[model samples]
Target: MRAAVFDRFGPPDVLHVVHIPDPQPGPGEVRVRVLAAGVQPFDVGVRQGNMPWAKVEFPQTIGQEYAGVVDALGEGVRDLAVGDPVLGSTMLNGNAELLCVAAANVVRKPHNLDFPTAAALVAASQTASGALLELGVGEGDVLLVHAAAGSVGTVATQLARLAGATVIGSASFDNHSRVRRQGALPVPYGEELIAAVRDTGLQPTAALDGAGAEAIAQSVALGISPDRIGTIVDDKAAAEHGVRVVRAGRDPERLARVIALAAEGKVLMPVQAFPLSEVVEAHRAVESRHSHGKVVLIIEP
Candidate 1:
């Protein structure tokens, strides 16, 4: 099998494509023939050693989420079968031709979704959905999504709207129209952001900080309930600021909902694809912090 392998991680340039041994499934697990892999901010952070809190082994294969077919199933796995289309998350090791995943971690891909969209949903979309659930957002509420044009923000805005919330999204002027297209009232992110949202007379009842920017802290200062604020960025100051976080190892139910929404075309994933051999470029694109969508790797034809 060929994979993007890195020894002593430093930057995206450290990643190289090379032949590696094929992984096998264990009991209650399945081996997926990877079709598409989602590149997340965590993937880049793990590769560049920015997440010192997370200990990763050397020669790591970095990827967080993927979509593929179950080529083989381990003993005790009965709900799935050979050739089942699935999307899932792994603590590591998704950026390859095959990955062994616990049966519980994998879900059948929505019948109407393609592999790329399925792959993109697990990480970003799920986080967005889970955040909205945590904040208790619903119909008639005003929800504000920071960096709403990004991968998670885009899905979150749509999900909020679908849940009947009035949604406001902050992005650069360049992406305002795109956010509006997703059913969010677009507000330009910067000094004028708060006022722009205020002009609409929508007092935000909840907030999701996908931006990881200083502006997020400022938003919290505007008097929305701290319990209603959550961030995917895992900023250390969240607790002190009375904000919440969506961390690793959450229950998979929120993710499952996001997958269903994608299949139903109620949610969207803007994604850019690169061949598996170009994993480094994909990482660079993610690290650039200007990607308008999720960056993904096409691992199989």
Candidate 2:
């Protein structure tokens, strides 16, 4: 099996493709033939050794989520069988042709989605779902979503709107149309953000920062309750500012909802697919933060 492997944290150039032994399913686990693996910003942090607090176990396999078919089931795994389609996330080791994970971590893939889109949906969508819940957004409440044009922000806007909150989103001026397509009122960042929200006379009751921009704190200054403001990105600063924190990487329920939405077609993931051999480029694209959507690495057909 071929996989993207790195020994030390650095740039994308440090990633290399090599023939590694195929991973076998252990007890309560299953081996999946990878169809597509999701690339995330955290993956970049891991590659660069930036997250000293997280304390990554080195010689690490770096990927957080994937969509694929079960190729083998290990002992004690009764619910999932060979050939069952599934999607989920983990701490690492997903960018490969085969993945071995515990059965409890896997969920049935939604009937409506393909592997590529399903691959992109789980991580971002889940985080967004958790964000909505953390803010306690409700009907008649105004929920401000920063980075509305990005993947998680787009899905978060839709979910917030579905929950009956008036959704307002921020994006660069060029991506305003994409933001609007998600059913939120789009406000461009800069002078336009505060002015645009104020002009509508819809005072925000809660806010979620999907963008890591420091300006999110400024948006909170615009009369929204500081306690109700949460961020998926600015975890460290959010705590310091008395804002709520929604941990994007961990929550299982959040990941599950996103997977269900993808399977049901209620949520869509824009994907740029790269073969497993191009994992380096995929990692670079994700690191750049300029890609239109989630970047994924595909393997098995």
Candidate 3:
């Protein structure tokens, strides 16, 4: 099996694919022949050695989410079978040709969802859905999403709209059209952000920040109560402003629900793909912070 691994944390050049021993399913786990893997900011953090609590070995594997076909099943795995198409969250080993993960954690992929798109939804879906749930966003509310063109914010905007909230999304002028297409009114970010949102004629009842510290401050300027402001990106700013840091952790159920919506064409995630061998370039794209959509590694391509 071949997998992307890094011996030392530094730049994108630190990542490279190399042959490693194939892993077999252990009890309650299944081995998946990975078709695609989502590249996340978390993966970038892991690669740069920024996550102090992430357990890292010298030659460490660094992906968190993947979609693939099941090749083998561990003992007691009754709900899924060999050859099943599944997508799910994994820990530090998803960017590989084959990965073993707990069968309980994997979600069955709908036939309508391609591997890359399915993989793309895994983390962002979970994060966005969880954040919305934590924020209690719903009918009669106006939700403000910072960095709305991003993976998490894209999902967040759509899901909030589905839940009956009016959405105002902040992005650069270039991405405003994309943001509006995601069912939100688009507002340009930076110093003029508050005025931009104000011009939309909607008072933000709650805010979700996917951008950094500046987003938090701008949301506060909109007169949204600190309790109603949730941030997944800037915890330090969240703490300073007395805003909630919504740790929208991984949840397979949340991911599955969003996946179902995607399969039905109710939710969409655009993908920018790189073949597995070009893992370094993929990492660099995510690091550049200008990727147009979810960046994914097409493992089998």
Top candidate on lDDT is: 3
Question: lDDT per residue, candidate 3, 36-75, as tens digits?
Answer: 9999999999999999999999899889989999999999
Tens digit of per-residue lDDT, candidate 1, span 199-300:
988789888888766656766866688888888884775866868886535456768877887777888888889999898889889998887678889986
Per-candidate TM-scores read: 0.95, 0.93, 0.99
lDDT for each residue of candidate 2 in 1-301, tens digit (9 for 90 to 100): 8777788989998888777799999999999998899888878898898877756664667788888999999999999889999988866788888889889888788677888888888787778887787778889998888888787887888888878998889888777888787888888777667888888778889898877556566666787887788877776778777787787455556677766765666766678888988888998888877787778888854
Model 1: runs farther than 4 Å from truth?
none
Clashes by residue pair, model 3: none
Location of the lowest summed lDDT over 10 successive residues in candidate 2? 248-257
* Model 3 alpha-carbon drift over 4 Å, by segment: none
Compute the lDDT for candidate 1.
0.84
On the 0 to 100 scale, the lDDT of residue 27 in model 1 is: 97
**For candidate 1, what's the RMSD?**
1.6
Whichever of 1 and 2 has more TM-score, that candidate is 1
Query: Candidates ranked by TM-score, best first?
Result: 3, 1, 2
Total residue pair clashes for candidate 2: 1
Candidate 3 deviation (Cα RMSD): 0.8
* Each prediction's whole-model lDDT (CA): 0.84, 0.81, 0.94
